[model samples]
Structures are given as structure tokens and as C-alpha cells.
Target: MDQKKEIKKTNDQIINSFSTELQTKVKTSISIIEEAVARYGYEGLSLSYNGGKDCLIILDLIHSIATGILPTNLTNPEKLKEIVLFYLRDEDDFEEIDEFVNTSLRSYDFRNYTKFATNSLKQGLIYILKEYPKLQGIFLGTRTADLKGRKQPIFAPTNGDWPESIRISPIMEWNYSDIWDYLLTKKVSYCELYDQGYTSLGLKSQTKQNPLLKQKNGEFLPAWVLSQKSSERDGRILSLSNSSTSTQIH
Candidate 1:
């Protein structure tokens, strides 16, 4: 099979793997995305990709939609040619995460769509917006359980004083387990940190293996084994506390 046909086959497998119930939800999310793209055009939309589990799910969803696995009103092939993918690269990011992001971009044929900024999230976003003023929307992978994500709508309009871009959270209703299920079922490659007990990812200095996942047999469990969604960020907070004390002592 040719590369294009192989890619399409992979996407079809992923989309078909979803349960009937999940498929319904996926369709709804895709519809929301299609509407947004229709309203602003593909050039006017961006995907906020962070190389995290949630963002990975969003990435796959977009791929499925673009390949026509999920329904979409977009008919122009040119609109899909240069769909912008934005990433804010922190200096303290994990090496594994960086590697995964690069590998996935190529593996998923998204190398041409990526835009990287080595600055703080806010600054990176501002820079991108300034560079691409036509961009009016960003597709985020924020779930309701994430920090400051509870109130975000599936199609949130931008604040008047903000960057003048809508923040779209199609998977806002999805939970922790939902994310893992989708990724694993789709045979998606994720950051290696998850296998090392890191439930949630952040700057390397502010993230660590989840202590709760340590077993009495001196073995570590994968992040997806985590039962509580709220505790996913415990490692991050613990790391921050340690960093703060180390700073004070110096």
C-alpha cells in the first residue's frame, strides 16, 4: 500500500475502535470543530498541542476528522494543507516529552503544520497570534478536571482583553480514564514518562513520578493505572514544593 493509503487505513482503524457511545461523542466534538473551522477558515484556526495525553487525543481526533473518518463540512483540500499547530516549548521540559512530540509530528505527517516557540506559554501565544493575525481560534485538549478547565466551554469565545482568539475544548467533558482508553485503543504512542509513573506532565522541575504508584514490590505502575483523576497532579505539586524550599535555602 502507498503511504497515503496506509495513513488512511490507520485512521480508519482508530475511528472504528471507538465504542458506539464514544463514537457519538466523537462525532459531536468533530461537528463543533467543523463549525469552528467553517466560521474562521482553516488558516484562521490553530491547534494548541502540548504533547500531553489530552492533547494527543485531540490530535488524533483532528486527524480522523481531516481524513473524513468523522463527518465534516469542510470540502476544500487547500484549507487542510496548512492547518497550524502551535506548541510552547519550556526550557525545563522533559527530554522524553520533546522526543515524543518530534517523533509524533513526523509519524503523523504533521511536520509542516508545527510552529514552536521557546518561551512562556502566554508569551508564545502572543507571539503566534501576532505573527498570524488571521488565526482566530485554538483547539485545546483541556478537560474539565484540569486546572482552570472546569468552566471552559466546548467553544469558548475569546475575552475582549485577551488574544482575540476563541479557545475550543472539544473534550472538556472527557475524564482521565477516557483519555487513556482512547490513546491505548488507537495504539497511539505517548510520552515515555507515563510508563515511569508520571500521571501528569509539566516542566521537568515541577513534575515527577507519582509516589502513589510505587508498589511494595519496589515496582512502579504506569500513570494510566491511577484511579483518582484529582491525584494526577500530586507529583507536580510535590515537585514545586521541593523546588521552593531549595530556592529558599540558597
Candidate 2:
């Protein structure tokens, strides 16, 4: 099928597939992206994508609205050259994760994707700011329940000591169930780690299959079925089950 026709079909499907609650969240998130574009222009915006489930949903949301939201210069945001994309590359990253990122950049036609060599999220942000001086905002795939997510506003600003840039948490209001519902209902592509019971992905050494999901047959369940929402990170070696803050940022 032609690119134009395919986009139209997918957009219609996306609108009809999600539940009413999820549709509302999707609309608000897209509106946030639109607001960011209005404030900084498309070229001045960026996205922090790491081939994870949360970020994958963010990417698909952008793709869903690309034909209408983005300028005509790129034909479609699927060309993905107008707005820069940043990935914090790490030495300890899972090979599967890296492969997914590489495949997605190609499949999405992300012509402006850049990778930072460091593992620290703080350091990666610093690197991107130094590399792209004109950037005014970067879309983050944050949700209401993530670490410090409940405390921050939708358009959270960087810390006083860090480089200044608008952190656009478009899906800040979405919850854990909403995340899974959007991904599965929309038929969106996601990383394979989730199906293997790694509910919260961290470094390869630190992350494991969630024991909460372990079955009597010595198999584990999918990430979405883990009953206790707070135990999502229990698979991690440094899981802070007792603390309110997240021990590791996926």
C-alpha cells in the first residue's frame, strides 16, 4: 500500500481501538506534543527513545499524528528527520534491547537519531544539550506511577544544576494498566523483554524475571499480569520494595 493510504488506515484504527479512558489519555498526550511544537517548532523538539514499552508507545503516538501534526517539509514525521532523537547507549545494555533500537530507527525512518556513549541518564542529557544548542524540549515517556513522576508537573523543567530544557511528559497521567492497554489494544510493537517476565528492565546483570509472576510449572508470566503494581521492579537486584522512590529508571 502507498504510504499515505497506510497512515490513514492506521490512524483510523488507533482512534477506534482504544477504550474511552485510554482515548482521552491519547488525545491529551498528542495535545501536549502539539503544544510543544507550537512553543519550540518541530526542529527544536526532541525525543528520548530507548526501545522500551513506554517509549515505544510514545513513538507510535507521534507516528499516529505525524501526517497532520508535523510540517509538510518532511512529508511525514515518519521520515523522522525534523525532530532529533536521543538514546543513552550503555555498555551493560541487553543485546536484544540494542537490536530493537536499531531495528526501530530503521523501521521508523528516524534520520536524526543520535546515541550517547554513557549509561548515566544525567550525563546523557548533558551530552545532548551540549550537542544540540538550539533544542528547547525533549519528550519523555513518563507516567504517573514512575519514579518521581507523581511529584513532577507534566512539563517538568530540568533541575537547577542540570542543563535547561523542557521535559515534556505527554503521558504523565497514564497508569500502568493504561500503558499495557494502549500497547496491546493498539497492536503497537514493543520490546520482547516484557513477555519474558522482566517487568522492569535495568542493566542485564541486575534485572531478572519477576518472581511474583512465577508459576508452579517453573515458568513466568508476562509483565502486564503481575498483580501487585508496586512489585513491578521486584525482579531487579537492587529493588527498593520498601521505599517509595524507584530504585532504577528503565
- CA lDDT of every candidate: 0.70, 0.74
TM-score per candidate, in order?
0.82, 0.85
Residues 132-203, model 2: lDDT tens digits? 889988888776666543377778777767678888888888877788888887677677888988887877
Predicted structure 2: lDDT: 0.74
Which residue pairs in candidate 1 collide? none
The residue pairs in collision within model 2 are none
Name model 1 segments beyond 4 Å from true. 1-16, 71-73, 111-119, 147-150, 238-250
What C-alpha RMSD separates each model from the true structure? Answer: 5.7, 4.0
Q: Which whole-number lDDT from 0 to 100 does residue 79 have in model 1?
A: 53
Clash count, candidate 1: 0
Q: What is the lDDT of residue 44 in candidate 1?
A: 85
lDDT of 1 at 2: 93
